[model samples]
Target chain A: MIGGRPDMVDDEHRLKMLMVAGLGGDEAAYRAVLGALARHLRGFFRRRLASRPADCEDLVQETLLAVHTRRHTFDRSQPLTPWVFAIARYKLVDWLRRHARQDALHDPVDEWRNDLAVEGGQEADTARHDVSELLGTLPAKQREPIRLVKLEGLSVVEAAERTGLSVSAVKVGIHRGLKKLAAQFRP
Target chain B: MRTDDLVALLARGAGTEPMAVPARVWAMAVAGGAVAAVALMALMLGVQADLAGKVSTLAWWGKAGFTLAVALPALALITRMARPGSHVGRLPVALAAPVAALWLAAAIQLAGAPPGERLALVLGKTWASCPVWVTVLSLPLLIAALAALRALAPTRLALSGAGAGLFAGAVGALVYTLHCPELDPAFVAVWYVLGIAIPTGLGAAVGPWILRW
Candidate 1:
């Protein structure tokens, strides 16, 4: 399958051919792999984080670089897509971690606060509707703990005290409740 | 850098070392470290005075055998982890079985022994320094493992580091056996495993930093 696919048309096969060639020291094939990978990563990150365009492009570039450096490690037995995307996933996580730390320390100036309020009304309404819909699906045991915890702003111990259950039992109920809610939310 | 520029850059290969197979790189790294550890041990901590006599007993072979057993899964884990997107699926089970088996053996030994003896068996003579020594010995191996990791890509840095550390710990224990006289399976099972765990913990702590591209 290496270098014979002059018109494979499939990304997976094309990528495999390019990787095989690149590892064999074909600069042209290696360049082709990067170009294709860059395009693939753009789509991948864009779908995952549509709100962050700059982050998406930056991540695409980082992932391509990583793939380039780590090309020798790509196992011939495995598919090309997973290896590429795995690097992308790591880059995304690192990016998220870096952004989280920066946000934690960089004081919020609130210059765009009013602008957010003006634009967020529709999104907030949808979010509120979705939350209630999701919360309504749970049983009383699970729902009550969630209400006490998330909705009522009570601590786990307080919620347990109010619910007449042991602390461990309350925690279990909360976990089970969230798990059920998550199942329902899955597409 | 722009994708075009990046491709052109890598294509140029300007002084970049030609990439080798991941397995070969890792094997060389770990193997080199093991040899270095052995050499260092020979120079700084010579073999115990009565290794030959102890070999006739269950202690010497028992320690060496057990250390090799623990090292097996760690080697398998690194083989898979040395590549990007390679799943570490159920590889942990491989690492856990030896520990769990040893622990079970220890518990059984403890159950049969007298209450006074059970305490002594669990805490061997060198409980305080065992972990520290193992950690120190693992540093060289860890560095080599980290060096090997640089050429390949690991998605889970911490997990990969832990694997490398565990491999080194097993190597450390293998070396420690040459000096120490403790023979009880219970002691080897617990303390030697603890020695290994120290490096694994450090690897987990530092992997994110060391393995970053």
Candidate 2:
């Protein structure tokens, strides 16, 4: 099922595989389709996570979970790569925020404030070092918007609403943020 | 770790998350869909008897298009209103069971009839046939709508079902406007409106109560 099929098969079959089998609970089919995605996603994270080897596995796991959860959104008729990467892009930004010690709404504000403000010892320093190294994976512009939006748990509308910028501009900020992250580890 | 190693590790490694699916939630969805289908069938049958005397008064396309226009939007809205991520995901699929049965009945009625004869058959069986495909296609749309709702964590079913109803209304109206014949706005206004309204209302009314899980 893997190498036997031609790589350039029509998008319809891929979508059918996803919809009929994937939605219908064919685990083998799900794995086969997602296997290619794993490689592509790994490459994406590798480029953004070169300096933060420790975080790569966690990032990849989180991204795959998202892909599994949101797989239905992939219109069966469209090319698979862009959809996969869009999810990957979102996951990557989410990881970067977690690394940077940003507050997410899901996290209790009091606990988060206590963890960041009070725990300022060597343990915090090492964790910060790892996160900052990951941050170094993306340029500052990319990191800043991600920190504000994803890490801060702001919706695109909310981010724009708060920043007094257009929603399109916020999306552009996220896009440019990714491009800059991609540029950091293009070797 | 090697890429292969990582892949294998993640592939085999135990998922830290739970795989628990709420059983009662799915049961309620299936049950609600059944109730909605039955209620809709009753409503349509009532309309058929009322319209039987006037079957020849309306044009052929007028009758069929009225049915279609109503069916398409109503189905779309019902499916759209059911959210994907919640327990209601199964509602569309469950609703499909009844709708499919109705479609089979309609197709059988339409089998030997000529175009002109078709209107009479539909008038007799319209209540039965139309809900099948509407319910079938709606399962997926319900899933998408629910996924969008998951993050919102709406506290009230009325709010969520209302959202689903509005979406169903708009989608139903738009789709009907495009494909259905505009013969008698009166016919369209009647059966077509029921076609859309019944399924949508069913989804909305039941969506919150059943999908609460």
Top candidate on TM-score is: 1
Tens-place lDDT per residue, model 2, B1-213, is: 233322232232112222222223333443454344335434443233324444455444444544444344433433333222222344445434534444554565466567787665444434443333344323433443444444222233554554444334333433333233333333333344445455456556765555442
- Candidate 2 lDDT at B12 equals 29
**Chain A TM-scores in order:** 0.53, 0.43
- Candidate 1 off by > 4 Å: A1-9, A107-187, B12-20
lDDT of 1 by residue, B110-174 (tens): 89999988878878787777667767777788789878876567778999888888888898888
Q: Pick the candidate with the highest lDDT.
A: 1
Tell me the TM-score of each prediction against the true structure.
0.73, 0.33
Across A1-187, the per-residue lDDT of candidate 2 in tens digits comes to 4324565345435744653454455544555555655665666787887755434545554455455543444444445555556556655654565555644544677765665663454221122222235455665545555556645656667777777778777666655653343333211
Docking class of 1: incorrect
After superposition, candidate 2 runs with Cα above 4 Å error: A1-36, A42-59, A66-78, A89-187, B1-6, B9-35, B38-49, B54-213
lDDT of 1 at A37: 81
